[model samples]
Target: MTTETPVKTSNWNVPNALTTLRIVMVPFFGYALLHDGGDSIGWRITAYVLFALAMVTDKIDGDLARKHNLVTDFGKIADPIADKAITGMAFIGLSIVGSQSGEAWYVAGGEIWWWVTILVLVREWSVTLLRLSIMKDVVIPAAQLGKIKTTAQGVALGLLSLPLVADDNAWGDTGRVIFYVSQVILAVAVGLTLWSGYEFFRDAFRQKRAARA
Candidate 1:
């Protein structure tokens, strides 16, 4: 008699599955945000709720993968793709809407600035290309500043969503204050994101030099 080994099922990978869910939700979230009349606060609120849930899944998948040793290349690649899809779309859509409304320059414009959004997109896309060029074996772990940038982004986006809670008093002067604060936070976040990208490049260069030596 021979003992048979149980085959590990790929379906059992929770982290990769969660990341895939996030990717799938990105288009749907974008549609909801862009399709809605932009007048109803409910639509924005719904979009925000979906965005928040996606973010929660990000945290969960990372924690679970780390704790259970279930990390995989699929998870690594899909996670960032999901992030870019969601954030890039949100940043662009908000800015477009704000600009079209002709209130982008106003203090309560509710629009994301094009320059700020472009900066984020450039960083995300550049790093993504760099990672692909270098291959998966060359791991560039998230810097401390990167984590701070993520935190700041989450806070700012959340505050922006707050204005969608009601119609009349949904986001009065208080919400404007929060919006302004978030703008500052987002500006800082962008600065940190660039700094973190530079750090990654510097570390990568040093490693290459050492390898050549």
Candidate 2:
């Protein structure tokens, strides 16, 4: 019997291009979010749009890659980097905006606490690094909690990116309601981040032990 060879897909593809676009967007998204110290309603709106675009593109690229067999090593590497870069910018930019906006504003469940940002970022980056580094030796399946955490984070950050607390917000009471909702979601996201991270670490250790045995 003849052995079948695996097909190698090239790096240049639509999904990879979208991933590249996401990487390119992080800085622009940050600029928009931080425009006029994150106080400009117009800029905030722009930032939200850019963020939404990135999120949508991320979903699209992953689907396209999986459906069409366009997955590549570059796509794998760049996709997560792009995802983290943009979201990390959102977390950092919103914290800055909240701080700059004084007591009336902040995206940390109402002026996102810097500690929240710091802790979440640490967990996110550490988990990502560990996953990539040990990918070959230990294959740990993603937990559903991790997916939930990501979705919650995306929704929270998207809502928080808006000038939710601004006096000039056209959304007015509606904006306040959305802000409250986003705050609740962010709190949940933070909880999930910690919980999921713990699960990931625990599973990783288990997997490593099994691999050695």
Candidate 3:
């Protein structure tokens, strides 16, 4: 009887390592944001730097995975988790700080409008669950609009993370402008997010119907 060769796996490769690094950075990023109640400019800067580094790792890891054929089940699962953790933390932290400080235009009556967070979370978690449910029979790849949404979210969060917007410094006006622009970008991201969620559900339904037929 001829022996069968074992299939090689690259789960422990550089791409996955970077993805793990991104996951590791999430707490540090949150700490920097929450340190001293997010009042210290130094802490905010540190948070922004950590966030940027984590975002960079996101890109590098995906590129490396695709380029070197290092993509694995672990990477596929962990990569999105890392992305959501970093970004979700950023959004929650920003909303909390905005509500407390009354500085963020997005906040009103000392409340950061729970609707925004609720909408985003609902879409994200629902789609993720739907994907998992159909994963055995269908593979739903990331769409172009989804990538745009991610980038917009990242840029908006990065802009909001900076201390300039909340400080009464020379750059305060600039910071305000950036903050407004970031809000616009965030709105676009939210729209795309909802649209993509609809598309995902639509496609899943169509596929299920087709398989039944």
**Candidate with best lDDT:** 2
- For candidate 1, write residues 62-118 as lDDT tens digits: 899889878766776677888778777778867765666555434434568788889
* Model 1's TM-score against the true structure: 0.86
Superposing all C-alpha atoms, what RMSD in Å does each candidate have to the true structure? 3.5, 1.9, 2.7
Quote model 2's TM-score.
0.94
Which tens-of-lDDT digit does each residue in 108-190 have in candidate 3? 21113457877887888788777777877877788887888889888878877877554446355666676678777888888
TM-score of each: 0.86, 0.94, 0.89
Q: In candidate 3, which residue ranges exceed 4 Å CA deviation?
A: 1-6, 102-112
The lDDT of model 3 is: 0.78
Local lDDT at 110 for model 3: 12
Q: Please list all clashing residue pairs in model 2, or write none if there are none.
A: 106-111, 107-112, 108-111, 108-112
Task: Give Cα distance to truth, residue 97, candidate 3, Å.
Answer: 0.6
